[model samples]
Target: METFTEWRTWERARADLAARSLGPDDLVVLDRAVDAALRWHGDQRRPTGAPYAEHLFEALEVMVRGAGVTDLDTLVAVLLHDVVEDTDATVSDVEAEFGPDAAELVDWVTKPPAGGQGRQAKRVAKTAYLRRLREAPPDAIRVKLADRVSNVQTLDRMPPDFQRRYYLETVTYVMPLIELLGDDTGGWFSGWYTSWRRRFGHLG
Candidate 1:
């Protein structure tokens, strides 16, 4: 696998985005969205020890450039996909800045467990989150699918037990949600899901 600093994954994403012919407006909006997300998630890092912005950018690139999604709302949602989860950013802040659709999409995708939850409670909360994701807006689902696809591809970089848990969660929780997106997004998600299933289906 490529080292994190090599960033081969991001390089491929950049190539795809370049080929997508994103308009000047698209570029402007995406730049603003990235800047906002960075300000919100300043200096945060994921468990995998990578800058959180990398994951956000990957999700946005997958949806906007890889899935051929041109809708402004979906693109914005992709860029801000993890803000509510990883930062102090509020849904109202997103709404006031990016409008209702983008904020709603981000809110739908954010999964917050019930306060003071234990293991079973967290599991129940997760189940409920997935259920709500089913009823969420299509743009939210699109951002979610893109996020899951990126996560699955990087699963190997995590610890063995975490990988197992994440794999099972992807199959059980995320795969169904992927089916709820628009045609183009569902197709992109299916491609990633099929590859993940083929490579890791035998694991617990």
Candidate 2:
């Protein structure tokens, strides 16, 4: 649990991007995506109280470092994945700025609105999202798998009840989606899921 500094996330993400050796054009696109996400998620915090951008960077890191993703559009989509869900940014805005493919990836990963309701509504929303992902493109599922990895990687920082429910959701909803990916990406997520389950499964 280190301090939530925006620079740290950029520093880490840049290092991973550099390792991939993206071309000049792709580098500029990734930078723009990062800038847009930072601007839109301004001053937002995660459940663990880290700056919201940290989660985005962590998700990208999981894809690059763990899953060996180097696709330019997928990486760009990773950067802007949450803007539509958490900020005022709309799907049309993402599509207009980042192009249809990247926007489509974000749209696939973004959960439907849960509204102001209890856990049941949120669970129903997530369940529906998972069903939709069953037929989503492999690349879209890759982003989602990486997102879940980043989320569950730090379960200790969350409350015991949250840990329990999230672990269940990951097993029930996410694992099946990972199966749909049918690539080594699913292996990466499964590794994380198994480790976290052993550590947190009893909390339920």
Best TM-score among the predictions, by candidate number: 2
Instruction: Tell me the spans in candidate 1 whose CA falls farther than 4 Å from its real position.
Output: 1-19
Could you tell me which residue pairs clash in candidate 2? none
- Model 1 CA lDDT for position 1: 18
Q: Write the per-residue lDDT of candidate 1 for residues 18-53, one digit (tens) a residue.
A: 567767676677677878988999999878788887
C-alpha root-mean-square deviation, each candidate? 3.2, 3.2
Clashing pairs in 1: none
Candidates in order, TM-scores: namely 0.87, 0.89
Number of the top candidate by lDDT?
2
**Model 2: per-residue Cα lDDT over 1-204, one tens digit each:** 211122347866686577678777887888899999999999999887878888888888778877778898898888888889889999999989889999999998888898659988887887888878888898998888778777887777888878888888887877777677667777766666677677767765
